[model samples]
Target chain A: MPTTTRQWLLNGHPRGRGIEIDNDFRLVEAELPDPGQGEMLLKTHYLGFDPAQKGWMENIADYVAPMNIGDVMRGSGIAEVVASNGGRFAVGDMVFGTTGWTEYLVTDGKELTRVETELSPTAVLSVLGTTGLTAYCGLFKVGKPVAGDTVLVSGAAGATGSIVGQLAKIAGCRVVGIAGGKDKCDWLVREAGYDAAIDYKAGGVKEQIRELCPRGVDVIYDNVGGKILNDMLACIATGARVVICGGISRYETGSLPAGPENYFNLVFRRGTMAGFIVLDWASEFPGIRKRLEGFVKGGSLKYQEDIQHGFENAPQTLQRLFTGQNRGKQMLKL
Target chain B: MPTTTRQWLLNGHPRGRGIEIDNDFRLVEAELPDPGQGEMLLKTHYLGFDPAQKGWMENIADYVAPMNIGDVMRGSGIAEVVASNGGRFAVGDMVFGTTGWTEYLVTDGKELTRVETELSPTAVLSVLGTTGLTAYCGLFKVGKPVAGDTVLVSGAAGATGSIVGQLAKIAGCRVVGIAGGKDKCDWLVREAGYDAAIDYKAGGVKEQIRELCPRGVDVIYDNVGGKILNDMLACIATGARVVICGGISRYETGSLPAGPENYFNLVFRRGTMAGFIVLDWASEFPGIRKRLEGFVKGGSLKYQEDIQHGFENAPQTLQRLFTGQNRGKQMLKL
Candidate 1:
């Protein structure tokens, strides 16, 4: 590793349509410092990029505080403890947390989760990290799908939605997926075990969903919001649940489209729509991680990552999330 | 007792703005219903009218099946059991249920909820019956307002809204009300004990709600939908719960105005929006009714009924809900 560490700093708040690396972020280098007592030097291995990062970089009112200019662009990643002073972590113990877009970080064991189990650390970041936990809790806890119910997953070829579809199937549900293109749609049914896949780009989303589900969707795992959300809302069954995890389609592209025009069906159908962040389920992370590990080891889970090499490409890679260019979990591999 | 009874039959499916009696209904006089074994004859004393009645009358997808043409219009009412063949009901018992828009009904003692308290039957229709139970359950059960929370209630001067406001206030939350007129606004703060009230007809509803709930609203009990629901959605606090009971503003008026455009705030704030109907909570009605009775007896609950005289005015009285002309529970006394 170099004596000087490189980190991308948030240079300017992202506005409508521009989130390019040169326009919104600055890469800065600083000399590495030794760890103090009760502190450790951590080296980034895998940088986890999520659609929510766009909201954090923007000046808009969002779930989290906007990343201030000149601050390290906020993110989550898997890292290895390089040097430590008497504490829970030792040198080379892998851990994952929000370590930001940095080559290395010094921490006092705060917000870090050990990458336990013999499974590959890269797999942990892709499927068992925030992505898997989010899919697990949002589906079962919020969506609450039961056997024989129809579950609709938007952005179904993506990281979280892929896991959600498989889980829904495991729970004895009829899973339907909505994707932008034919390839992703094919992947949803062929690889992810979704019962059916609707290519939303073909239009007629409402009619397609209606014909596929027939009885209307029992739960909607909405990742890509905007018009797709409205389509699903229009066809949701009575006592349905919309588990809102991400709105990647319009997160920071430009203006947010209106909320679902058919949301009142929730009233007529006696349904619920809830939004959640994975951080709120930290207490159950261990159980969630273990279950995800079992799925992986048992070959029941299919995982993929759009690995963008080098920390320097972090900001550029983040743009793919909103542009429908990312196939799965978009990660920065150091 | 009269040898013949008059009832309003759904003559045509109401569409657009034609909710007038002569356009959509016909008054029919039928021979009085005679009770058989395990049955009773219910004399409708007060016919309850609600905005949802329009949905029931139309051939539309709704919470309940639309009333068929030529069938007696579906409605709830306060009634007295005039004759009983045995089983649960006795003569002279005042009860409230789905007794329809008729002067008399015969039932097998199935759905009637006994109005046993000393409060007037009119008060029972307004506060101790479905109206009050809806407010209680939708607020406490679904909205789940915590102490010191800020609750905003749309239609705060109407029957369900009036009760929701007081109940939220009693739960140790700062209650803000949104009503149409200055008189209704004044009544919300004065009689309903709402901490603040915004007169929506005066405009700047979003601005007023922002000013009143500077910390952001924690729970929103929405009786009206459309623009005001959108406004509340834009400014709700983290973990907020939006309780959707009725959309009086659009239930009977032409097409449903598009669903609230600001609903994405639920994602940004990690909040929830649920739509519920009172019929789902029938098992818990006894508890809700008892709690509301205590509120009334202790003088904490104040209720008003916009009582229109005579059965002939039932169709016209039902219009008041959609027009915002009814101050409280809209009931037609026969």
Candidate 2:
């Protein structure tokens, strides 16, 4: 029988902060797309929420283009193949890629990479997926942490940040985390194995980091950019390496926000700030994934996923991320 | 017989623009001290006036220390060894190092590097000394231009920029130059062999760059930093390398000014902005000098020196650089 698919389409641009973006998306019903030759029908299982999605909603020119009006809000998720006309995949096989915000999608299996892990699908897609790779390549390739180096990670309790802090620790460096609220701070220290945690909500983030890492930061993996980045730029040691992993703090803005005002600190300290995307190092993933998965299973590294159920609440669910309501990797179980 | 030496001493900090520094220096007479064991007395021949001298006068915490009040202002120039107790440097042999601004000075011969080249003194310091080393090592090590790549240099007709542009040409890359005046622009295109030259004084630097290098700038050797750097930041191609060789634009300001407002473009383009000091690569310099000298003698590369006779006019001489009165390498003959 032919089926009906429910999806959220971007109808308007976000205007205000927090849940303001809730009104930008509308839920609608569409007919299920059938698989043709060399194609497969994917049934959505889980949607991983990322700050980059906000960039797509704003229609701003950046690393990636903005999502146009009436388009299914772009997102990456884990899904099952319910029907297939493709030779590579059989029915009941699960694949991961940009499945969008929909219950069902028909693709030629062009972009999808088959999920081949025995662990829970959310665990693989959350930590072992793009989130893990982003932090892994960004820290190792760009930041280049050496033994006894002082590493700082902003948004340290979040999905990617949490993984980055642990990876830096495994490299035999002191890991300091900057996160908002007390719960996140506690988790970074108690669960994620950070050397120290700074509560930005309590203010004095710069002072705390200074007190903790008196020798000065050797590398920085910045997810949140703004005054926080400006303050940290001043405290780097000579020949420091700063990796621009993401700038979630300014993603909601209409125009690209001004860069950190104190970037000359790079000159003062003779440092290097390198911006990169994980896909640039995608070819080395098989080795990296095996390493990250070992850390996850060995209990040396810990990750958190904030999962919610129900596809109807997609808009408000995304709002949870911006409002600081999300505890970890924000995800929706459909 | 003991001789009296004339030198400029740092008397005050500069507070305003355009020769305000005239008051910052005071002419003083001091007895020429005799060289001790393993020491030599140097007779100053040419004092190289560079923008970094402004930083030395300000007494700020940077790569080098600030000149103290009533102390001989720190500078690097070419000098002839008049008397020597050290065997490494012989009497009448020319040497290069930080000889400061003086008619004659005595040194322990510790910092002086022997000048073995047969070229004229000003030519060696102008194109083959630290100025040339600053451009050569900076462009190759940090900027890392590849063949057929598009390279842009600011301060185009000036000492460092002229060498950098020609080096890019030698590397088989397309080179563009940005200079402040039409004459400088003509020299860059006609004399220095740049693919194109933009008169930044006429404005629209970003547009001109975009139009000339449709493929986008692969590497930028930036000598001036300010809005000019901000504009160039916007035109960099993906994975571009930006070498922060100098920031002459804001050197005279009282405070360290804001960084490029468009620096986030580094993240968008997945590029690198690296800061380096020429001394860091001093080991590779003997080889770099031979290569640069060959290009100069072969007629493929050219350099310019705006030489003013007299050490008494050193204060106003530096003003020529700030006010754009000097056409090329600003040099003061003792």
Candidate 3:
């Protein structure tokens, strides 16, 4: 029934590392189009913020297409089918997909997946969503933690890192998290079930990791790259598996950051470093969600969301991820 | 038999990179000890110079023990058994093992391997010894080059790199080699059977690799690390496998050198980087040697050895590996 909608359009490519509100994006009022046959109109309930979005904003394409000037910012979100002409979705049905940075969208229903209404919006957007699936697949498939293995996670206080720590603990590994501050580190150890947490803000990250994991880390799930990744590489155990989940540290940089200087340690340690995208495992997401849901119901896995209000704050909320200002899975409620 | 034997002793850990004979080694004359029970006395014939020997000289212990200040310089060589109390060997038997930079050694024969007398010592040391096995397992097991894959090798004119390119070619992959100069690059394509070669000394190494492997490198066998490793990381294909065989570039540095800067590209390409040592595959060396020998015998695999004469030139011959002076497998005839 709405005649107009609001969108945050990409106004320009970032000139440097930081994304500027005024320069990089523009708030616009757009005419709302009606859904044609086989299509449905979605009202975005919440927008998801991820470090990977910064890469999407670059001129080069990665797992997904790059964001271009004059385009609605590319993103994922929890949305509701407000108007439907598609057989796959009905009005009031909740859905999740690449909903972009918009208050509303008309889709052919092919890209969207119907989400469960029983769960709250936070759960749908965080724990039972792509965030949870990434933690599950990356930790299990790539990190491949064995029971009693010492698993180190960078960005330990963030949404995916939190779930990864919990899931690693559930899998019977000793979990250590590296977070930016005392508060986040405390949350990691107390709330997220990490055996230990390193406050990178306090410095001596390498010595701290060495003190805690004296025998060396067996599995590393890295979300923060740059010096953090380098530190982890320095102390990995023989035959260690390093899962390159995300490199939040370098996402906003004009160029890819310097790599782990000790990566040559892989030869000395006879280890493996691998990288993957969650979208690559889309076909098996249903199964991954079911497994994670079981962990949630059993109280073994816990997740948190840091939600902001207003559609206009979308770009600012995304900046929170880079600055480490947001506590958990960053989201914006429109 | 001479009562006195000459040995090169490690005088000191080099204060900086680049081995110096006068500063780091001392030539000493010592009494030749007789073989005891379960032991054999061997006279060195051919000493094999390897990039890995430089790692053994470092203060830290790697796959093998570090060279102590008073210890004879560690090396691998072809030797002939002159005396034996061990049941495993008899007098005049040709054997190969870690003979060190000494004219004679008494060993229990456990570390030694019996080599074929039909093949020349160069073939035994360069194509059938640990060098060849490194190429075999690293290429087939770690690199996993499937038919039609683009295989790129650094140090492509060296002993291991030459064999790696030939092996990759035999495996039905498109082989591109990156070597130091025009002569080395020409030898790689002409003699070693590489599809193409890039002269890294000409500069624009990255541009050359991009031009050669336009679809991107799928299997990268890196013996030389540093900026060259960083270059290859930039243009890897999706699902590429990087086999970290050696880091010759960082061997003599007082500290480990900086690693590949574009390693984050692994995430974008969904690739794998693995490192390994050949000694770990000792159990399978026989099987691997048989495979490599088949290639050599079938005239499909070619190898070249850069042999230097005189025991006094041992340190200088080893230096050839670092300076890009040795044309193929660097060796010294004692």
Candidate 4:
């Protein structure tokens, strides 16, 4: 029998207390198994580290199932097919799916999507995967940006916002970004084609947003809710639209973040604020995927990866997202 | 010179707290002015009494200008053009516009819309006016209810909600109404064709809503925003839409209403909460007016008027609204 490595499990739920890297997880070993009917055995290569994974560790129920105690940490990963019992893929075929944090995973062939070598495997797990699709659907379908509209994006240099800013520019909108640091702000304006970038840590968000968007913002792609969203609400123009894609700011707070106090601005300005999840537009994936891929191939869109070196770093890498430490899409390499 | 009784200025601004209804206004005898090259002299008949008028009374910056302290209170009134100097109307033709609370007035005829008596003068101020148009725009344009979708309407016995509930039912939706009392709830079921009714004052709004909408609410037309809006958020189905038409509960609080705490539910269920103002769809009024008139004429849509006897009672009558003392559309008889 060929030798195999076993997976590790995160031991307990992280609720009120902040995540402690040392006490939260444990490692274990198990026997290797043969591929069953229509199943494939996968060797994990690149693991995706997202802020949502922290949510999985916490007790609060979000859009998906919560991670259970003693379960392999839930995540998406790029893998190589080692043993296949299906016609869809063979040994050496590359695929991606929710394989959790592990060295090897056995899943039904239908669960994995076959990827082409033309695109980088890491890119498929980052920009061309769920994160990219989420930005596309939330902006176009819900935000509905028109040409010449002023678009304000929170978490502007993060995985989703970087792509969102580029896409808005391509759609002929004037984009303004809100990021945490000077470096991210500089990158957003210099590399991502943002018209203006605001460093949220410096304060005066409402004043800076007012000065940047004198006519007021027409579309706000909000990733970090709480105070930033409240400030955005005050700066929205007549008939504006606010798209709530994520609320990363409140993820670590012991209590729910206070909601926008000036929500009545929606009533007077005749604006709209809506929240959405990416899975709702799963039916439109093929078309959006082709367009996003074309943008990447043509160099109109840029995908950045903050790749962590090993599997053991997954927990620490996810912590980087909450601290605003990662530059772009955070990924783990094994 | 023919004598005319007019309510005009006694000074420039009101003194101390509360609306000074008694000593602040004065009745004077004046000569009726001749119409200018393109103006008309109007004789008043009925005036619209709205809570929005109270907003105009307060000295605050809003979408429209506030009523000056000593000036005739700004109001919407039905008037007859006693003398005309243009092609728009002849002597004794009926018209409607922002005519003040007075027996006689003169205007350029430009802002006055001719009232077609084929539709009652009262209908011009009720269903064919701003109240009806607000309900029409919100229900069709924002809520976008489909056949068989369940719609929950707050303040379902008020001027707008009463019409909104019937309209939703006419559009083939199962309607549930929320009112302040059992009598109002009965009125919504018996007169407005609502499938179920909940008296919010009696409590258990969340439980009652769940019982009424087993499949969950597809759309909610919220007027009284506060705990009711918060409670309604819990009952929304996948892809539900919450239309914020007005927030009467928060109006008196002098601050924005606390937004629903479970707003993250928008992402969990893939739903949307959008705030709207009627003026955004002003261009569609003629089309909506024609359809709504048909309903009123055919007896499919019935409106109840909570008529206050005289203009002198306007302030006291306005108090009826906040206390839930009035039944339907509150209007003042001149």
**Each model's DockQ?**
0.60, 0.54, 0.79, 0.50
> i-RMS, every candidate?
1.7, 2.0, 1.4, 2.0
Better of 2 and 4 by DockQ: 2
Q: Which residue pairs does candidate 3 place in steric collision?
A: none
In model 3, which runs have C-alpha deviations exceeding 4 angstroms?
none
Residue ranges of candidate 4 with Cα displaced over 4 Å: A1-5, A10-26, A57-67, A117-119, B1-5, B8-32, B54-71, B117-120
Instruction: Tell me how far candidate 1 lies from the true structure as C-alpha RMSD in angstroms.
Output: 2.8
Tens digits of per-residue lDDT for model 3 on B1-334?
6677999888878634778767788889988877778888889999998887777777664656767898999888988988888648889888888889999888888888887734575677888887888899999989999999999999999899999999998999999999987888888888889999998889999999999999999999998888999999988999999999987778657567676868888888999999987778889888887888888889998888888999988888888888888887888998
lDDT per residue as tens, model 4, B221-312: 99888889888988899889889888777656545667676666676677877777676676787788889999888877877777777765
**Model 1: how far residue B113 lies from native, Å:** 4.8
What lDDT tens digits, residue by residue, belong to model 1 across residues B38-93?
98888899888777778878778666776788888888888888888894778998
Candidate 2 clashing pairs? none
lDDT scores for all predictions? Answer: 0.85, 0.83, 0.86, 0.81
Which CAPRI quality tier does the interface of model 1 achieve? medium
Interface RMSD of 4: 2.0
How many angstroms is residue A208 displaced in model 2 relative to the true structure, after the best TM-score fit? 3.0
Candidate 3 accuracy as TM-score: 0.98
Per-model TM-score on C-alpha atoms: 0.92, 0.95, 0.98, 0.91
The whole-model C-alpha lDDT of candidate 3 against the native structure comes to: 0.86
